[model samples]
Target: MRGPRTQTERDDTTVEIVYAAVTGVLLAGAAFALVMSPVLFLGDVPITTLANLWRAAKITAVVVFAARICWTLRRFGRR
Candidate 1:
């Protein structure tokens, strides 16, 4: 078993967590906007299709957010 984490290790973890969350939000927002851009740029889209696109955008945002967080943590752990 490993020993307890030192102060610097704890601080590094806190920093990494914050970094992951911030970057995740930014990346997720960008992904959501990208996915929903068709609604903004295209005219006369049907309401149903618009709703579907919105749903897809939300899903994409969530996936991107989770992925970024996991990737960041995993990469940090590997270092």
Candidate 2:
């Protein structure tokens, strides 16, 4: 039989794997958004809102990355 793993050890392993994956996904997504968001969201907005939407998308991307990191940490302990 396989040896037992305490919860913390399992959690650590899961976190290490998932965090790496999430980090990659977030990075790729952010790169795509940085290129496409300004065109999609602000392409036709007035002068002021154009810049605003671009900035907002960027800020949101940062928040998304942060949230994913936290989620990876949080999901570690789950069965």
Q: Which candidate is the best by TM-score?
A: 1
Candidate 1 per-residue C-alpha lDDT over 1-79 given as tens digits, one digit per residue, 9 for 90 to 100: 9999999999999999999999999999999999999988897899999999999999999999999999999999999
Tens-digit lDDT string for candidate 2 (25-59): 77747764775565775456686676676677667
User: What are the TM-scores, per candidate, against the unseen true structure?
Assistant: 0.93, 0.50
Task: Note the clash tally of each candidate.
Answer: 0, 0
> Could you list the CA RMSD of all candidates, in the order they appear?
0.9, 6.0
Alpha carbon deviation, residue 50, candidate 1 (Å): 0.8
Model 1 off-target regions past 4 Å?
A: none
TM-score of 2: 0.50
Full-model lDDT, candidate 1: 0.97
List lDDT for all candidates, in order.
0.97, 0.69
